[model samples]
Target: LTVGPPPTPIPNPQVVATDFLEVNREELQRWVRGEPGAFDWSPFIQHVCKIEGRGEPWQEKERRLRGRLRRILPIDVHCADPLGAPLRPPADALLSTFCLEAVSPDRAAFGRALLNVGSMLRPGGHALLLGALGESFYLAGAARLPVVPLDEDDVRGALSDAGFTIRDFRSYAMPPALRTAVDDVQGVFFVHAQKPLEG
Candidate 1:
């Protein structure tokens, strides 16, 4: 998606509702405030630019991202409890990264969470998920937090069970240098699944 500027209001422009959920709201707030060294998103933006063949400078991209963040207020923060407190008005698409695997203790919980998240989307809506694969635990500061080691099959099965059709999926093995840096994750996966249209 092109991250230039928010589109101007047109006569009946398509409305795409969105919401933010985080296990730790404070961390998200810190990142929004542009705190020093808070969640570096440059690498991700650069990667996308490379793939899309967009040669925009880093400064411009950062400016656009900051502008978008400025629109977020405290009221926008929502609890990460997928099965409990869900956002209103539902969403057309949901993007989650590195959160489900970190919080889900096992495969069952992961499936449950997937279903819960799917519930937040309207029929025919899409969900994009990215998470570490085959990772039992990851280091958080000085303590080790648990992660459910999941493979591609596990993810595909869970998504299917959660009433989603897998549209796109990919995986990448962790590099040797990065593998030993923090977590013992074997690989990472990116999945794009769509809910079935209403009959």
Candidate 2:
């Protein structure tokens, strides 16, 4: 879901809906225009679609994604304040990438954010999280943004405390060449977890 407000001011609720869609459409266009192999999002999208029993041809799927992106704006909810945003009923699954790590200043904050995210899920719901592991900072445009360095153990403990059961977890070490190219990120972690059904 695309949470938070649009880049520009929205005069009204209706305008908020429209502006959010426009902003997302522009961002998706920018991503699609990047060099080939710059981002391999298709496979991941396909996998999710397959699991949801909505798989389609690559071209069709891409078109659908573009169409959906242009029409949908999930500005109704924010991770830190899900209830305040009035996200009712909860979601069956959630996917977050590099968000909590970028915004959280420390391990405790990360854990809190994780709990907040878990609260958005229905019981037995799944979550896929990808974040930079052991990263203190990353460059954003011209400014350096602080990141909360978290390890596998920290993530596991946080998920468990958040009422989630670990289903899959993987980490990748930063390659020497890529390590110096951008930030001092030691590696990245990919985690798939589920909220306990009993809870």
Pairs that clash in candidate 2 = none
Q: After superposition, which runs of candidate 2 have C-alpha atoms over 4 Å from their true positions?
A: 1-57, 67-80
Report residue 136 deviation for candidate 1 (angstroms): 0.8
The residue ranges of model 1 lying beyond 4 angstroms of the native Cα positions read: 1-24, 30-40, 67-85, 175-177
**Candidate 2: residue 3 lDDT (0-100):** 48
- Model 1, range 97-132, lDDT digits (tens) per residue? 887777777898888878877777888888999998
Candidate 1 local lDDT, residue 27: 61
Q: Which candidate achieves the best TM-score against the true structure?
A: 1
Instruction: Judge candidate 1 at residue 171 and give its lDDT.
Output: 97
RMSD of 2: 10.0
